[model samples]
Target: MHRCTLSKEKLAAQPGGEWTHSVSAGFLKTLGCLELLSVVGLILPAVLDIAPVMVPVTAVCWVLLLTGAMITRGRLGQVKLVAGDAAYFAIAVFVAYGRFVIEPFSS
Candidate 1:
């Protein structure tokens, strides 16, 4: 009987944090997916054989956006998730460099 009440309390306490994390992470994950597609589809094509400045500009914007996300998570005491945004920022920078300069010069 006592165990049942303890289990119930534990279950009740979980949704509050889990749901909040799920919602926030879900939002960021979806946006990250879009950004990924943009990097490959839009930025890469632009940098490879077309207008070049937009790709770097987009990369800068992406890094700034992720920084803002990290700041928000910090304000919410969710610093553990900041690593994901940091990775995204790094990938964006890498994509910018690889597409705009490295690939063009190597080939």
Candidate 2:
């Protein structure tokens, strides 16, 4: 994982790891940690029915994160990567809208 690897060379060895060079390891690790937590926030509360509203909140957070990702990729002229980010952004937006408006879980 790029986040765990301290050596730039080691990170570059992995597929798509070259992107790690654009940012500091600390930033990457922080981002990775946040993403991991966002995933947990998306699933755990909903599954346990403890705070299902967190699912939509997490989805909204993911959308914001992906928006930053898309801007970064676009600035780097990574058109293909931007497209992928757009797809993820769309999915996050859909999830947020669905959970918040269409089928929100009742408390």
Q: What is the C-alpha RMSD of each candidate to the true structure, in Å?
A: 10.5, 2.2
- Model 2 per-residue lDDT tens digits across residues 1-107: 53443465676566545677877867877887788899899899988988899999999999999998888777768788789889989989999999999999988
- Scanning candidate 2 in windows of ten residues, the lowest lDDT window is 1-10
Pick the TM-score winner: 2
| Cα error of candidate 1 at position 50, Å | 2.9
Clashes of each: 0, 0
lDDT of 2: 0.83
Candidate 1, residues 3-97, lDDT tens digits: the string is 12233334335522232343444454566565666566545646576555566657767877778777766676766667777888898788668
Worst 10 residues of 1 by lDDT: 1-10
Which candidate has the highest lDDT of all?
Answer: 2
Candidate 2 regions exceeding 4 Å error are: 2-9, 12-19
Q: Residue 55 lDDT in model 1?
A: 65
* lDDT score for residue 41 of model 1: 56
